[model samples]
Target: MSDNSGFFERVYEVCRKIPEGKVTSYGAIAKYLGAARSARMVGWAMNSSHNLEDVPAHRVVNRNGVLTGKHHFGGTNAMQQLLEEEGVQVKKLQILDFEKHFWDPMKELPQEI
Candidate 1:
């Protein structure tokens, strides 16, 4: 595994902790991991999360709560569908009531360092 493999594992751990019906941003996960500018790396980890059954990548989105990675979830609507099933509303590829559903790992998880 590359050094990023550890980063990806950490990302997966954060993603797994996202409660059902809530969501978080790639940037939030990156910042939680101590790399504020590694939002794209968070996205990259998410792209690999599909192989893990419990990663819950559907609970992750862009800062605006847009379903930017929806296409990776098997179809254009798959990610949105999963969110909707969990009680989150999506309209025009954007999460409705985003603030209400937002789950920040930094706020929710206990500090490890």
Candidate 2:
């Protein structure tokens, strides 16, 4: 495995833990991983997450809760569809009531030693 595999694995693990009805920001995941400036890396990991069925890449988004990764999901609406199916509201590619649906890995998961 590549060096980034571990980081990507950590990303996927946190992503898998995201509750079905909630969503999180790439920055949030990055910060949780102790790489607050690596939000783009988190997005890159998500880009490759299609190979992992258990990784809910669609549950991740930009800081604004915008479905920025929607294009990677297949069709333009695929991401939105997935989020809607999970009871998350979307409008103009942005999640409605995002704060209510937001999930923070740092807050929900145990800290690493």
Which candidate number has the best lDDT? 2
Q: Flag regions of model 2 displaced more than 4 Å.
A: none
**Over 4 Å off in model 1, which ranges?**
none
Score candidate 1 by TM-score against the native: 0.95
Q: Please give the range of 10 consecutive residues that has the lowest summed lDDT in model 1.
A: 104-113
Report the CA-based lDDT of candidate 2 relative to the real structure: 0.93
Tens-place lDDT digits, model 2, residues 6-110: 999999989989999999999999999899999999999999999888899999999999999998988669899999999999999999999999998888999
lDDT of each: 0.92, 0.93
TM-score for all predictions?
0.95, 0.96
Weakest ten-residue segment in model 2 by summed lDDT: 104-113
Per-residue lDDT for 1-113 in model 1, tens only?
A: 68899989989988989999999999999999899999999999999988899899999999999999988988768899899999999999999999999998888999732
